[model samples]
Target: MNASADPLVSIVIPVYNGSNYLAEAIESALSQTYSNIEILVINDGSTDDGKTERVAQSYGSRIRYFSKENGGVASALNMGIEKMAGSFFSWLSHDDLFVSEKIVRQMDALAHAASSESICYSNYYVFTDDPADTVPISLKGVPPEHFRYWLTVENVLHGCTLLIPKAAFTTCGTFNTSLRTTQDYDLWFRMAKKFAFVHVPEMLVKARSHAHQDSHKLAGTALKECDALLSGFVAQLGIDELKAGSGQPGAVSYARVAASMRSRGFVEAGLVATKLCIKHLSGESPYTKVLALFVLTRGALMQYITKPIKGLIPPSVRSTIRQWLAGGTKKGPPGAETVRGMGLKEKFSEVYDKNIFRGSKSRSGEGSDLVQTAVIRREMPRLLRELGIKTLLDAPCGDWYWMRHMDLPVDRYIGADIVEALVAKNREEFGSEKIGFECIDLAEGELPKADLIFSRDCLVHLSFADALKIIANFKRSGATYLLTTTFTARTSNEDLGTGFWRPLNKQLSPFNFPAPMLLINEECTEGLNMFTDKCLGLWKLQDINLQ
Candidate 1:
């Protein structure tokens, strides 16, 4: 462990608030069998209960600690890098956990590729408290030539998984502090300019999924920063092309410019560029046109199909959708009288009792029942198992009967409801601890932490903004998986179709809505709208891990 002879690896960690996981990260760094390491932790003016000094003191003199007024993660990282004395440099996010072999494995890969490549990265596993979750793997066999192309489309590198030579840093430069988010991508792009980047193809880090991480809280800011970075890069590329006196623009350059403009809230500019790109490609390159068409078609479909649902959705739901679109917060109200009035509870209860509770006896007379509750009960367990989830936080978990009927692992369950009567009934039936019923309004108050948080058939009753807030709250609580249902069928003034009648035959008795009666009035035809698409979108597992 000689400081001078050993190939010192400087592990720089930039810290902000909520450093609960900092100790784990530092211990992982220290416990690395690769002893020749200098752990440099920079505290970026975190306002969280003296987390900086606490972690530093705990580490004693084993690690170097530097504290500065809040300047942002990039600034803290830059300062850390400048003060480092290691031959190789790497960064570990304050909240992220590194595996014991992380440094040694990364170092080995870098040393092996030292002559040919300047940077190296390894795969990392995503870990959450929820047992049912899958770790997403990074793409393989991505040639360095296509690295820029891949980056322009999506970020492939995880910041915590990267290891680069100090010389690489000297060449590529430190992160841009001015940029709020995507500084890592900005730095990576700069590094790619000079160095060949390679993936180690080994999982060497354990990235934590938790609430309060920068990615979840400052998603909007991050997106904005990414746009700024892209704009700068686009400008640079344009200048370089101009200086080279090349009249023909590069395809990569055009794509990057268009992408940056799109990211920076310049959709019209992006569309124009995309059209020009299509024309250019149509004449000179067919492959580019194909890619453009694929992207365009997908975008158009999403906008067109979801537009109706987006419009019809109550304001609360719309707000949530907007937040998600902005990559900000997510979550919605747990209970509202309007939502309760939807008769969803009764519908769910009846189905549960008939199929789940009574089992085959309840369906002995009926040949087959293929309804929503039956579908939910049959599919939910399979989905949960497939996702590798063992725990569930059934927020506003209406009644314990669903749990009993679903027969999921009820050992680790928290059933919350705003209605005191429902909570009392659940507690009385299932006992307080086993079902753990709580009388809390998720819409108005804080939520408990859980691995997989969900409230079935609850989104429609909430305004969009409240829904977004609920989602954001779940994310903050560090839930890795979410599964909630929303109403998507359109109610219109038209004759009941034979096919529709057969499907909803049982529920037809309760169909007394105004729209069904309005079929005789031609004037009300315009008000009829369909909400046919039920969207089930999840954050890509990789994005969750990276956060």
Candidate 2:
């Protein structure tokens, strides 16, 4: 298209006593590479003795300036939207700056994409002082279709990064005048319903975060608005929307949404999601629901309730009491009794206490042997270097025996184990600022975001059911890669009790994992060197086939 023929992008700068940063925003807009643009400065009742006015007037007809009554930013933006002649609308907060290529890049994206979604947004940088030090906030690795649902989880979008079609305001209606702090997001939530937001995935806008910003100044009001906004968004939300948005199963998505709401201090909103979470969980089969209940509650229940109670009771009486509470556990047929009421916490503790895996009682078993770990120790560092792995989560990091010996190319190392005593020991002995330890059950507890999850020798002890939960936990953790134990030669998979020994082939039957990106064989000596096929398979968590 010719210069004039190209769609005009109207950059709207709304200011309320923002004279200090107004010039920079205006300059950034004026410096845009895309020529077909108009900069409209809407002076939102700035009371700084005409300072903001002079900034706009100094531009001297290079920009269009308009003064409005002392309404909030929403009203100012609405005025700009109504007056602009451009086909597209871009909001530029007086303190925020657009990259020179912002409009052109988004315009190019719109022209090239086959998608019908008219609203376009890109990743933005949060800056305090210099642009170089700004931290980029990238949205979830989801398609444009799920951005709306993802909005239900959390708001990571910035209004300045958006290049909304002018017609979108006409179709979805302009921003809610009543909403002061949450006006942009309220508008976004509405726009998302009518249109899928196309994420450009480029740092197009530099958003300033200062003590003077509205977010900091109006913190109390913002919290109230956030609660109401999210409550309204998630009120009548469904399983399918949450499923597609979170990329998790039905009940799991609701559970996540509930947890997210709780973290944000939106207790009422969390209760709403929690209600839906329970509603969906009730629909599951009786046994599956029971299993979910145990797995979900085990970590917290054991740690907060049982762990303290454990100290009071003798070790000999604890098992008998637990079995009694669970209606006296009877050994059912193998594979049928996959969930034995006892979870990873109890099972791993028993293994540690009894030396069931057959090493020393103080150690983590034969699996943590220096010789057994030699292959991984040698190969892992190089692989981490290649993948640029920074933060690593070694779940079920048993006793820290073999890993402590290796020099890993990692920035942060988190060793998580279900056994509380073991985690405490590891923390007291080896825990530092860089090397941390958390007591978490992979099948139940949350995993922190890391570059890689080194789950060596972890899944082999879990049943297929528990293994599925662990893998799902890995996905939910937002971690990139999973390095877990899998037997390459074992084509057939079998389900076992959680504590029992079984060769798990992640690529086979129940798991149906894709071919690993890399596999490092441990070169087995178990059962007189019988299990030579034992190896750790590596796969991107995203590529794992959940079905």
Candidate 3:
């Protein structure tokens, strides 16, 4: 294939006595859809006669061949980096095959990227010799820039899955020759600090899993290296990174990381990580402390249960078991269960008990996705500042899952819900001197007084009479203002009973709320844009017609 103006990406295959699959690996590099590329085969010293050399020679001038003492993969890779003519570098293991479109797709992604040193990786397939055993792994859908934050827990990024710019190697330096087991990740960690890595979300490489791999043969060494790597990584890990990566408080993620380290038999490293968890937990509110404790308990439970069960599985069926588990990672759209023939208290009780609103990967539902709440999160602080609002009453605050991550500057926060059990859980896990949880059913009696009522995603589910009763209750509370959910695109109102739901335009018909003081678009992207213009509007309570 003729070269093009596009930047050259060197496909570097470092082999050590790998004639068994060297030719296949070379063939994959040659078959790339991207034409602006060069193939470099580094035959790291092989003691298996000249079989590996013959394999490299058979490729002729199609690949640039070089041989050296078996210094290790890191050394071979460093030699390839020094000798490669391409501006970009891609490492292809002698045993792994790249999908035909890997380079071309990554090149297309880089064309749109703003930074020059930015590296890119993609999802990939892992398999044994049998093609039927292939399993596609999906990486979490985080934006390219934020990947480093989440990389704390990500272990699946294979060397072959990466298409890296050569400049990154120059800037971050090549793989550590001294490290035998973790050179790729060690260098990647260094580069991750200095460069932005993009995730392409497409499966671009098929990795071969075999028993002869170093990780399988030298398990002790690999575990030690992994623990060392984690030791350094955990040392630098701080609250900001955890919050950015997980959208949760620092202590929760720290405890999880600690639990993960301990479960892997790195007891000392795990203890250090636990100290970091405790350091962050120090002086935090009771809510955060309880939440961290809850996370730690859950992690402990998982460790106790899964570790034993994993051991009990037969080696013969481990492959089948893994395949089944890989398939289980995918979750379908959450089913919205019907809550029919139940009382006001029983209706919401069932909703919480059954978790009927499990709409997104988030436990609270799709209404609470970080992206869905992005607009409102940005707007809330400003609204609070402008109104001088010191306290907030979050009605029907189910789970407090998404909101707990938010940093609201309120003097006091009262999370109220209809489910008594949910309220108790919230109070136990999230209540503190400045934060509180209450069992409240708005359809009934007088509401608690607050500077403003931040009632979101509430009115749409209630009957028209119940909504009126809640609105009257809101008025009776003598709160200065209300910020609540409304679908502005909705031209008319459709009334439903307490257990059912449809979009309601508060400005129309029976409600006829005046033009809102502020219409903060919820930017509802939950389902295929069906609920567009669903907004949280702000209004002064006295101006609201309570009749």
| Residue-level lDDT tens digits of model 2 in 402-435 | 8988876899999988888889989999998899
The per-candidate count of clashes, in order, stands at: 29, 0, 0
lDDT against the true structure, per candidate, is 0.56, 0.75, 0.75
**TM-score for each predicted model, relative to the true structure:** 0.58, 0.55, 0.54
Model 1, residue 244: displacement in angstroms? 22
Q: Point out where model 1 deviates above 4 Å.
A: 1-4, 49-51, 114-117, 129-141, 227-276, 285-298, 303-433, 436-457, 461-547
Model 2 TM-score relative to the real fold: 0.55
Which ten contiguous residues of candidate 2 have the minimum total lDDT? 299-308
Rank the models by lDDT, top first.
2, 3, 1
lDDT of 3 by residue, 37-95 (tens): 89999999999999999999998989999999989999999999999999999999998
The prediction achieving the highest TM-score against the true structure is 1
Clash pairs for candidate 2: none
